[model samples]
Target: MLDALRIEIVEVSNEKVVARCPFMMQPDNTLDSFMGSFNSETVASVGSWNLLDMENEYAIGLEISANHIRGESEGTVKATGFPIHKTTMVWEIQITDENDKPICFSRCTTAVNKRIKKNNS
Candidate 1:
């Protein structure tokens, strides 16, 4: 889905992760605006990627809520995820837009999962 939306990961660190996407309108429309689902996905992607980078463990999104404040019809939109709180196996993430605006602020709860080894039988 990231490939289809052209979402790109621009940065990652212990504190935050950033993702970018260019504004693209629907085929039959000229709005050039993105859907709320896209904004939600961007938040989850950055949040999940941050956990993976920090812990070296796969993180599964357990819950997410996105509040879209505004929409853009031009320019690129960037989503940055910050770890506001965390437990041993879960993280609470907050996301903001490129202009430091609240495009779609979200809270994501992710659970760290262990990768299972496959048996080559």
Candidate 2:
């Protein structure tokens, strides 16, 4: 589903994760303007999930707050996620345009736990 949106991982490490996606106005937009909030949130969530890298675990978003600062209608937008206050489940996300200009800022909090195993008969 994400691939369909053209979101891709740009970088990943123990410290942070970066992901990018092409920006375009949603087809349902009547104003023909770029709606960046949804894409920004998606990248932020995905970045945090990748950074966690909890094997056999699940991470569900508890909260996500995004501030859309600037709009970019062309090229790709990238989001970088960093841990906040050294906490494993809280992240600060920054979204930038292709030229590395700030587009959005976000904070995400997620609940992490082991994935429940399914019983097989």
Candidate 3:
């Protein structure tokens, strides 16, 4: 059963991945069971999620603002290579296996965009 469950951070963006969840999403619902059964910090595994090259090629940069994030959070956001911002953020999870080796890693890339465009006028 354990062998059936494995985690890895796959780009899974655009043509990167044609499918979802390298592992099964549903698990036996028990007191210990969770939508995410990771045993480590969620951010430990993920590093950063960045804009696609195609995205960066368009404009000088995204007009990131508070609306770019869900809710009114002003926390630090980051892209894979970018230092930090509020438009795009990264979430990573790390889990160790019975052999005490780093086995599972999962990350999610979520973006927030400005609802309105601010004009310099």
- Top TM-score model: 2
In model 2, which runs have C-alpha deviations exceeding 4 angstroms? 26-56, 85-88, 115-121
User: Which stretches in model 1 have alpha-carbon errors above 4 Å?
Assistant: 24-56, 88-98, 114-121
Worst 10 residues of 1 by lDDT: 88-97
TM-score of each: 0.64, 0.72, 0.23
User: lDDT of candidate 1?
Assistant: 0.58
Segments of candidate 3 deviating more than 4 angstroms: 1-34, 37-87, 97-103, 115-121
Report the alpha-carbon TM-score of model 2 versus the true structure: 0.72
Note the Cα lDDT for every prediction shown. Answer: 0.58, 0.66, 0.28
Tens digits of lDDT, candidate 2, 4-112: 8777877776577778787664454221123344454555566556655466766777777777766566777777877764344777878787788987787777777
| Candidate whose lDDT is highest | 2
lDDT tens readout by residue for model 1, 15-103: 76777777554564332334444555456556666556443467666776666556544666666667766442233333344565555
lDDT of 1 at 37: 47
